[model samples]
Target: MVFKKLLSAFGVGGPTVDTVLVNPNTRPGLALDGRVNLVGGDAPAAIEQIVVGLVTRVEMESGDGEYAGVMEFHRLPVSGAFELAPKQQLSIPFQLPVPWETPITDVYGQRLHGMTMGLRTEVAVARAVDKSDLDQVNVHPLPVQERILDAFARLGFRFKGADLERGHIRGVHQTLPFYQEIEFFAAPQYAQVINEVELTFVTSPQGIEVVLECDKRGGFLSAGHDVFGRYTVAHTDADRVDWVQVVDGWLQQTTSHYGGLRAQGFGAPQGFGAPPGYGAPHGYPTQHGHGGHGHGHGHGHGGHGRGVGMGGIVAGAALGAVGGMVAGEMIEDAVEGDFAEDWGFGGDEE
Candidate 1:
């Protein structure tokens, strides 16, 4: 997902830059390395600075309603005060730690439906700077994360869709202005209790804070409510983990947890992850659209927008009686504009 192009913003005859990341996918608390290659377009110019920033689109709550904005959470200064001569080619190598709370972009080498990430390059000339390239980054889950997901699948919970969310949960330590949400269809055993489920991860050095939102469907005998459950996990245990049993435990524990808000002893230590300290990031309030069966307004744009059938979990519900639902929030996949045709996500029933 790396993007390379001539530094067009600086005009013609400027240096062209291309960024190639070593490997796009890895678990949490790992390093993402790559090289930034620079080639003189016409002649070498004085290069003053090279900067890289991690950016993502997030939802924001406002007086009117929920909106989307890009949040640049982490930045690194690679090099400074360098010169490029005509026909000169230089590559700057970078090895940086992705924020412990960085969102997971893929699962088992597959796209997580609607998640998007980019590495933006900024080149400085003298005192001025030019935004150069945007490299689409693909990040996968940690081993433990994968195991939990596999358990859900094996238990018959189909993958729905995943996307970064804006804002913070009510009682969480947040540093960034957004979080990541992964939605899932209910497993057959729990179909009668919930229509769909939305998952969010807020990570820190200790581990990841897992937030689960169960969207209950209104029926003749019952109304609906959004049931939330939060938990944590350690990093080192990912390798030697019993993820299937652990995740199943979470589902079982949470499903039986009704009536009032529930918070359990799930947080664990995984050592320090980079710098800054332990705190979650972002702030996007869950928005709800009217008559919409499930979550919030952010759901549409949060993913690839509505037409894409972006969220697989909600779509899976449509395949069954307890299925077929309109996701209410997250702003990740649903769209209100002229929705485009869905591709890559759906075709025949799986």
Candidate 2:
């Protein structure tokens, strides 16, 4: 009994909780099935409520500068209230629905670089502090998302990294407070005009809104700047057309003289032919500048060389296999480090 009373915010004789996910791997618009196991401490405790939430690290802008912090985007109640006797045990099963716009942390079993997700379980006691548990969660891409990412790889875009920014796009519909940006180095073909590209997907039940930000290169007299493009695609068209050609066309249009029009806050040029079943391009006006808030932090575009491209390196392999192993280890370290220490929500209020 003494050993069972490991740790809790309700002092020594308080209940301890452990949340176990039946299957940690899931996709957007899906549900995560799990059970919460609780063991009563040496004394009887009045358990008030139980809750679970989805949390992730988001880079936010402050007056001083930008910093990364854990934010709980969604939460669900598991159990109402109960009274546990000493040495008693109880199990509560729950099904938490993943948001349609949830940022993907994994692709084809590979953890995306610079991304981390966790499911947090919090138990409230009547008159004592709360006890919480954290579990790592892997969110894979939807079918359409997978296809688009595959197209980028095939187009010779090398994966740089990915992170969530705390802000909204001026024209896109977003449910979550923050959005994710998957960064990539420009392919050899477009290297002369653009330095890199950042991809953002705003998904819903019917389809997705694809946003692209191209970092154009600076010439002798002019300084470089970012060009934006927004396009819509239906889920049904995921397999109806050749993605390579479609994506290539998008890059060409985005990096062309059309960028000059976007800089002036204009939509796609008239008579611009979009791919079959795809919506015409629109201008993406980020809240602040290039990356929503301000300059992107923690995303390093140096040291990594341009070579065989991401697709060639992981030919026939998983979608994000380019830096999967290293990213996996990095996620694990985060789970044990900052993620564990910072549960995001403090006390019984949240």
Leading candidate by lDDT? 2
The local lDDT score (0 to 100) that residue 129 gets in candidate 2 is: 61
Q: Mind giving the per-residue lDDT tens digits that candidate 1 earns over 1-350?
A: 01112432345556777788776554445566788888864545678888776655554567877655445667788898787776698999997677767787755335666555666666665422343655666665643455456556656777777655666777777666667778888989889978888877777765577777778666798677776677776543443444445666666666564413654444433342332112111221111111212221222221321212233333433221000001123322221112111212111111
Among these predictions, the greatest TM-score belongs to 2
Model 1, residue 196: what's the lDDT? 85
Q: Give each model's whole-structure lDDT.
A: 0.56, 0.68
Instruction: Provide the TM-score for each candidate, comma-separated.
Output: 0.68, 0.76
TM value for model 1: 0.68
Name the runs in model 1 displaced over 4 angstroms.
1-10, 63-65, 127-131, 218-222, 239-242, 257-259, 262-350
lDDT of 2 by residue, 174-258 (tens): 8888889998888898999999999998888767888889999988998999988777776555444456677788788777877
Clashes per prediction? 41, 0
Q: Give candidates' CA RMSD values in order.
A: 13.8, 11.4
